[model samples]
Every structure is written in C-alpha cells, then in structure tokens.
Target: VSPKGARAASAGMFITLAAHVAAMAPGTNIGAAHPVSVGIAKMDKVMGDKVVNDMAAYARSLALERGRNADWAERAVRQSVSIHAAEAHRLKVVDLLAEDLPELLQKVHNLPVKLNKQTVILKTQGVPVHIMEEGLRTRILKHIADPNIAFILMLIGLAGLYFELAHPGVVLPGVVGALSLLLAFYAFQTLPVNFVGLLLIILAFVFFILEIYVTSYGLLTLGGVISLLMGSLMLYRTGDPGMAVAWSVLIPAVLIITLFFVGIGVLILHSQMRRSMSGVSGLIGERGEAYTDLNPEGKVFVHGEYWQAVSEEPVAKGEQVEVLKVEGLKIFVRKAS
Candidate 1:
C-alpha cells in the first residue's frame, strides 16, 4: 500500500510499516523519505529532529500492530534507511512477490488490512485500475523544475527591470518586469535557491548601475560581469540530476547580459555628452527673418515666434538672419550677408 506522504512526512513511515503480510512487484522497493535541506539554519535542524522522532514513533506503532520487530522498524526510521524487494522479503518485511499488477491484486484479494485501529478487507481481485493525472499546479511546478526555464525566467526578470529603470514612465517595461518576476518566483519555489548566490546577483546589478554614474574605466563593469557569472553558477546546488543550470546556458546568458549592460552604459554616456536638442541650443545656427531693422537690437521671427534680437551687422526689415546666441528670451543674430 502507498502511504499518504511519499517521503517527507511521518505518516508515510507509519503506513509503509503497517503491512502485516506485505507483497511487492518484482522490482519495487520501500524506504524512508527525508527532506533535504542544505545551508539551513538552526531552526531547520530542530525541525528535522522533530520530524525524525515523529516518524520513528509512527514506525514503532505500526510494527506493534503487525506483531513484528518494533525495535528494528524504529531503528530504520531513526537511521533513514531503505530496503529493496529481495532484502525486504528476506527480513519478513514483505510476505510475497508478484510479477505484475494482476498477480499482486490476486495476492491482495481477501487480505485483512488494519488502518488506524480499523480492520478492513481488501477486494482487489479483477478490480479495474484508475489512474489520476497531475493537476495544473503540479504540472506547472514540474515544468519550473527545469533549470533552463528557471534560468530564463531569472534573465527575463532582470532584463525587464533594467529596461524599466533606464527608461522611466514606460508602462510596458514595468508590466513585463512584474510578469517576469512572478514567473521567476514560481521557478524559485520549486528549485533549490542559494540566498548568498542571489545576493551576489543583486550586487552585480548594483555594480552595473554604479558603472553608469561613476566613471571607473570599466573596472566596475568587469567586476559586475564576474559577479553575475559566479552568482548564476552558484544559484542552485541540489544533487538532483539536470536541476542545476547548464554551462552552455550560463555562458551565453552572461555574455548577453554583459553586452546589454555595457551597451546601455555606453548609450547613457553618449546621451550625457550630447548637447540639448531643445530651447536656445536648438535655435543656434537656425535661420530666421528680421521682422524689424537690426540696429544691434530688433524683433526677429524664428520658429513661428517673434523674439527680441541683436545683430552683429546692419540688416533691413524682412532680411534673413542667422541666430548666433540666446540671452534669456532674446536672440542674437548675424545677417546672412
């Protein structure tokens, strides 16, 4: 019988230990399933101890019900041990073996089963099997378990936020950033995330921002690139195969991010160095008509607006003049002679 909790709950220990006369398929196995927590704090240790103790007690109770060796069951729980089909049969943990589901069902038919102080009879002979598929949430979590998808979410989240910050008031960037962040969080929920590595990634972003303001001759940019690469490499460290981000994904992602930040930084610097394209600076060297005679100061028409102007040379009314400088609301001009 499969237990309520597969590996991470005390209930599983009790259920798995409850079979007085157990049988298994040819290649099946039974074991204790414990939670994996790395880099956890003192609270984690305390919780783990509590779970282990609870599981051991449950296993002992099941052993008592089955009239088997309770001490051995308790020991197994305490040690987080597992036994395969052959070993389990040798130790009297399982009573019989079958080659297929039909055979197993035939073996289980009319067997007396004890569950939570209730004695029941299982009628499994010739019964139709029903299989339930995973729900949407479970399916989504399974997809997020993939390292490539998780890494992609992280990259998109960072890029969207960067774009939103660089160009404020753009609603699209903010919306995309929020969506990407939500997806990243969903991915993180399933994957083992290292907070220190996350902190390093955040620090890299800070360096990239600082590079924009502080002229560090690419020093801050280089540091940011290194930090980002290291942080991505160390983001997840579970022993699960294919759970960690691939080097192929990491190298390309780092290159893209570095190029993005450097390109943005250069663009920002260029924008800073560029002259104003509006107001007085925009009018310099622009041709306008002298509305009145230019005796050092007169009214000139430019860009559909009349302005008080001063000229370097003598000019007649309606003569075209080029703007040389702007003093407050006034324009200084030279005749287009």
Candidate 2:
C-alpha cells in the first residue's frame, strides 16, 4: 500500500460500510474510506470541510456499529489512514483471514450475524453458491450508457427525421426516426447531459431551416455549423473520460451533420434555379406558327394548340414564330429564325 492512500466516493463508502455491518465476521476486513485515493479533489473550503466531516461521521458510526476500530475509520477520512488485512485483524477490524472465500466460509461456519431485527447463523458445510449471468435488460442498459452509442443513436434519429421532411409521406423514415429518438432519449436519461448544449443543437436545426427561407448569404448556415460544433463539444460535461462523448465520434459527427445541411441547401438552391417544367410557363421556348396576321397582336399555334399571341415584331398570316414568353393565357412570340 502506498503511504498516500487512495480515494473513494463517499456515498459508496457509506453503503459498503452498512453492508460490512450486516456481514461482520472475524475474517472480514473493513478498510479506510478516503476519497483522495480515487482522485476526488478537495472542493471549496466550506463544502470541503462539510464533506469530510460528514464522511468521517458515517464511517465512524459504521465502524462502532460493527464493533470494529472506529478511531482508524475516522483517521482514514481525516488523516488518510490505511491498513492491510492482517493489520486490520490485529486492530479488531477483521477475523479469520483466509485467502479464499470458501476457506473464509469454512472458518466462519456457525458464526452469528446480526440482521436488522433478527439473528442468523451461517451453515455452509455442503451448500453451493450459484452465480447467475446478467439478464438481457442489464446488458442493454450497459450498452445504452455508452456515450458513443448514445451519440450515434441521436445522429441517426436526426438524420432520419430530416430525410422524412425532405421526402414526405415516406413511412420508413418517420418510423426509424421515432424509434431512434426514443432510444436516444432513454440513453440521455442515464447520461450526464447539459440541457443548454442540447438546446444549442436544436437551435442549429432552426438556423438550418432559416438557410432555406432567409437569404442571409450563408450566414445562417455558418451560424448553424458553429452552434452544432459547440453543442457537440459541450454535450457531456462530466469529467470522467468514459462519460464523455469521444473526440473521434464528436468530430466525425459534426462534419457529417454539417455536410448533411449543406447538401440539403444545395438541392434547394438547384430546385429554385431550374426553369419551370409544368403549366403554360413551360412553353417559354416552343416554336409555333402564326394562326393569323399580327400588327403585333394575333393568334398562334404552339405545342399542338392554337392560342392567343402577341409579338414584338409584326407577323404575316401563317408565319413561323417562336414563343418569347408565356403570360397567363398569352403567348408572346418572335419570327422564328
């Protein structure tokens, strides 16, 4: 053991101490509970002192309750004390120091245990201890707690919904989006998420929509990209590395999502730039024949139909012409070259 002891979470320490109280035996050992050993930093002076004092009291109570060494427990918190199992047995913290659980159980057979309001005796000469595999739900929950998986699920949900919006009436996208979102929300509930970060991500989507409606010269899209990047960076604020969304996942996701918006924007712009493909406006470049003479006003045959016509130049009857433009049942024409 290092002279510098290890840290532990205070709440977990207290709970384990209670478990120690229930399972007290001459062979069992109760070690120190020092948060510093596990890398918990000392907080603000006021909060720090209170935390230490409270932890000390809880450990002290558990020690005394089990008739172990309370003084050593307090020293573990206040002075960062630690002791080996043999040393703990000498200090009345443990008894029957066998290396294996079976050996320990054999030695502690017929020993008395104090339950909340009952006394129990151990009897294990031939009894077997069964170990069960984790259930399906437990496995699922474990995977869902992973930040990378959660982040991926959220991206899938957002993409699915965007595709659904772009190509409406597609049942598959909506169904996939709804399922992915439900799973993502479940994962988020278990993760340490910052709501402000989440809101920024949603705001990014709003900016993306504005890029379609408001012509801000791509300013809105730039803002959306910045917001998305910031949000991805701030998604999980916990200091634990395992709880954080990995840079590998964050960087690629941000890039891909930005590309998604950019692609959508380009498609929208292309659609707007295209010439009209339906209705009377679709006849802008059709060749036709003058049905009657026009002193710049006459009828013309176009697209296999005769219709009202006007021209910038005069046309003799039956002269060939080309449509200059279509204006609400009127075809403006010019003499075909």
Candidate 3:
C-alpha cells in the first residue's frame, strides 16, 4: 500500500480501518482521522473538544475491531499524528514495512495470520496480479471532482444566466444556466466550499445587476468586483491544495467577468443616452417643409418623404417645420423660427 500521496479524513480513516494485515512501503503513510482535516482547524474550544473526543473514540473502536494499535489510532484522531513506514511497522501500527511490493511479499511469505479463531498460512508462491480497469462512470466522477472543472462550471452557469436575464425569452441561456448550476452544485457537494464565499459570489452578481438601475456611478460595479475577488479567495479556504480553486482560474475569471459586467453596463447606458434612431424616434429633430396648411394636422415633406404633421399653431404652406415628436405615423412639429 503506497499511501505515499495524500489521503485523510473519512476516506483515509475508513479505508485504513478495513485493511487486513496492512503493509506500508518506505516514504508512505496512513492513519489520519483528525476532525481538523474537515476544514475546521480553528473550531472553538468546546466544540473542538467534542469533535475530537468523538473521532478519537470512533478511530479507537475501528482499530480495536481490526486488531490494530488502538492507542496510536486515538492519537491519530486527537493529535493529528503521523509516522513513517519504519516507525509504523516497529510500533505494530502496520504489519510490515518494505521498500517495494516484491520485498513486502517476500518478507510476508508464510507469515502466520490469525483468521477468525484459526491461524492461516500465506499462499504467496506465485500469485498472478490483474489490475482492475477504471470504469467510465468512476473516471467521469473523478474528473468532476476537480476544482478547476467545478470553477469552470460555475462561470458557465453564471454567464448563461446573465445572458438569459439581459435578453429574456432566450430559452438556450436559461436551459444551459439551469443545467450548469445543477452540475456545479453537484460538484460542490464533493468539494469543501465555503458557504459565505458562495453567498458573496451571488451578491457580486446582484451588485452587477444593480449597476444598471442604481445610479451609484461605477461604485457598485467596483464593489461587485471586489466581492467577486474576495469570494473567490475564500471559496476553498480549507488548507488542502487539492480542494483549492486555482489562482490561475481566479485571476483570469475575475478580469473577464469584470470586463463583461462593465462592458454590458456601458453599452446599455450608452444606448439610453444616445438619440433614438428607429421607429417614432427616427422622425424627431427632422426638418421638413409644410406641403399644406397645418391647421394642427396636415402633410409635411420631411427627409425627402411626406409625413402627416400636426402642430399647435397654424403654419403656412412652404414654411419650414421641425419635428418635435411622433405618435404612431403622425409627426408632431413646430414652425421654425
């Protein structure tokens, strides 16, 4: 068992407990049941004591059941203790310690093992080894557990929802957003996500939307960006590098989203400030000549075409008029000074 890489908490503790005649290679490790590994290293005194006591009892019981060193197991849970393979074997925490598998098999050959009230002899003459192939579902689930993939899912979900909200009645964005959010949440179930961080991210989106209606200048947007960055930083503050959101993903994502939010807000604001150039708006400020007496309602030639023009004061034919507004096809105008 090369436990050389990292494994801890529930998976590590439970799997180690189930091992029979467990062996460890050099530079390998086992036995980590600390509650602090659950991302609450700074838990308060009373609660921390209770968690430690409970985990210690649980680990000790598992050790006793497996006929392993119960004292060391309790220490593993309470004090977050670890030891090298040589020490582990010397302490009988593991049955054997060897440099590699061949050495381990040779050392353990014919070693007596107690099997439920009977001693068993090892049959290690020439055991054929068949490696188990990873199933497709397991492989896919493994990939889904990646923090980078989860982060990408979150971004995709947010972008889709943003598009859907900005352009309502577009079914694609809403559908993609819903699915991506669900998948992201599924991934989050496996990840050590800080709820406050998740909430801050949501708040950032809220602020981004508020920039459109609330006239806080760009302050709300700046705050939103800050919230996003802080939220991302706290998203996986659990100390474990395996569970952390990558800085590479974080920086680029923040920049892209900041630009996206600001760009969208600017376009909308610009459109609102610019003169209307379509529909009834297109006729506003257009200069035209009255073709007939606008006894408040008559035809006027504007933009090289005739339009039904209306004015409060009477205007003579061939008089220059400026369009003030448009109601349906009727052009409201005033006589030019």
Candidate 4:
C-alpha cells in the first residue's frame, strides 16, 4: 500500500504487487520496478538483459499470484513505466483506490485474500487503527544506518583525528574523532560495506597526510581526490537507493573533505617551515646594547634581559653589538658596524 502523494517504485513495486490486495491512495503512483545494478564493474549487454528478464519474470509472477496485471508488471520492470492512481485502477495494476487509511479499510473489509491452503476475507471495517511510534533507540539506529549519515560520520571522524594528530595538544578533536569513528563502525556492521572502497578512502587520507612531508607539488593531493571519489562511488554495495549515498551528498562531501585535509596539511607545513620566534634561536641576529664595558666578555641587554656576551675584539661601554650565536648562558657577539 502507498500513501497519498507517495510512490511504490523499484523494490516497493514488488512488495505492492505481492500484497493479497494491492492498493493506492489518491495522488499516489506505482510501477518503475527496474532493477538497479550494484556491481562495481559495469554489466555487459547480454548480462544486463539477463538481469532485466529475471526481474521482469519475478514481477510477473507476483502480479499473477495476486490476480493483478502481469503484463503491466513485466512492462514496469522492463521499461520502468509508471502510472497514477486512477490509471493504475483502470489498468488493473492495483485492486482499489482510497482517499485515506479509513477509506482503504472500508474498501478492503470484505475483500477475498487467497492463502496457501485456504481463502480468507478481510475484516478491516470499523477496526480501530493504532499507530505505533518508533522508540528513541530505534530512531537513532535508523538515522545512523543511512549510508549518507554513516559516510558523513566517518568523514567527521577522519577530520577530527587529522586535526588532533596535526596538533597533538588538542584533546577535544581526538575525543570527538574516536566517538564518531566508533559510531561509523557500528553502522558499518549493519550496512553493506565494500572493504576495498574502505581501503581506498583510508589510502586517500594517507596521501593527503603525505603531502605535508613529501613535496609532490599537488600530485599527492590530486591522487587523494581521485581515491576519495572512487571510494565514495564504491562505498555501499547495494542496489537500493536508500542504502547508497546520494550524489548530492557525495559531491559536496568529497570536495569539502579533500579541501579540509589539504588545507590542514598546508597550515602544518607552513608552521614547520617558518622561523622560530622564541627561545635562544630567536636571539640570533638580534642587536643588543652593552650594559658594561667589555675587554673580551661583558654583559649586554637583549630581548629585555641581560646576557653574558663574548666578542673577538674589544668593545667600549654603551656600544651596540649584534649577537651571532648562543651557547648555554653566553652569547657570541660582534660590534655593530
């Protein structure tokens, strides 16, 4: 049964036809039972025909058993045809049409349903309908089970981990990353995950990280992008659209994640290559004023503090000197030219 403005398409078509009394609400549509290929490799013409024929036969069998339109069922599977509620009733694709659930119940009250060993008549009239709501845990599991949600969670986990690794002191990112990864793994247990695709995604992250150390001139980043795209395409091994990540989700996710990894890598590399601004190394090449007269060694003020300084030549009092190097508590200096 399909609700108003809803459709019984693809796998839903098969289920609808198998019902003892198939039905559609006003403004609803049905048909389009074409089987989608979930294989990583493209099917050849002959193999494609075989799959279509097989699916068509199954659809035809279901329609015949339910005393529906077998020819329309076959056409639905083979040609991906669809029909509105009124047209479906005219074509015998559906047994009845109703405005709502109550009307449907009223219509199917005395409808005959064939059983394995007997014929049964429905007693739906005046049957009070009680809708059961999903529990919190069930709702959470349902959201998590979605391929798009799982994929996003996995990406978030990777991004968090990447941030944590790049800057180790950040505790929040690591914690978030670990939790997201756990959830993603839990989802994977129920999802149809392709291990090869998983490996490719991991490899993509590796490539992005390598960009920071190895100077590949964007080659590594490009490879990472390619790997990510391919992995996204092959992630879920299922023909069901609900089980697969939508292209809308995939495109944005890939672009955003790729930029994120590469951007982080660039920031890290820049920080590593930049000159130090603190400690002894920072004092080198700094000019300081002589605080005391120096025959060969004296005190000099540098970076707002006094330091022991040594000069190869004699320097007078109140002279400015340039620090060349720092060793322990002493700084090698030369008179400012």
Top-lDDT structure, candidate number: 4
What is the alpha-carbon lDDT of model 3 when measured against the actual structure? 0.79
Every model's Cα RMSD, please?
5.8, 7.2, 4.3, 4.4
lDDT of 2 by residue, 1-337 (tens): 1112322223443554555322232333344454431111224578767877888888889878877777877887776555554566677654445655576668768887777778898787778888699999999988976878877887788778877987899979878987887888888876667676777887887898789878899999999999988887777755333456788888898889888888888988999989877777778887889999988898998888988999888999988999888788888899999
Q: What is the TM-score of candidate 3?
A: 0.78
Rank order (by lDDT, best first): 4, 3, 1, 2
Pairs in steric clash, model 3: none
Candidate 3 residue 207 C-alpha distance from true site, Å: 0.8
lDDT for every model? 0.74, 0.72, 0.79, 0.86
- Compute the lDDT for candidate 1: 0.74
Off by over 4 Å in 4: 9-14, 26-65, 68-93, 114-127, 167-171, 189-196, 242-244, 303-307, 327-329
> For model 3, what is the error of residue 159's alpha carbon versus the real structure, in angstroms, after optimal superposition?
3.0
Give per-residue CA lDDT, model 1, range 15-76, as digits (tens): 55675566655555665544344431222678978976876777778777786557767777
* C-alpha positional error of residue 157 in candidate 3 after TM-score superposition, expressed in Å: 2.2
TM-score ranking of the models: 3, 4, 2, 1
Query: Candidate 4's residue-wise lDDT over 1-337, tens digit each?
Result: 5567798989889989988888888888887777765423445689989999999999999989988999999999888898999999999999988888888898889888889979999998788899999999999999987889989998889878988998899899999998998899888877767778888888998898888888999999999999999998888876443567899999999999988877777787889888777899999988889998878999999889999999998888899999999999999999988
- Runs in model 3 deviating more than 4 A are 3-10, 36-51, 65-67, 84-87, 98-103, 237-241, 286-299, 303-305, 308-337
**What is the number of backbone collisions in each predicted candidate, taken in the order shown?**
0, 8, 0, 0
**lDDT for model 4:** 0.86
* RMSD (CA, angstroms), candidate 2: 7.2
**Which segments of candidate 2 are over 4 A away from where they belong?**
1-130, 162-168, 239-241, 289-298, 314-320
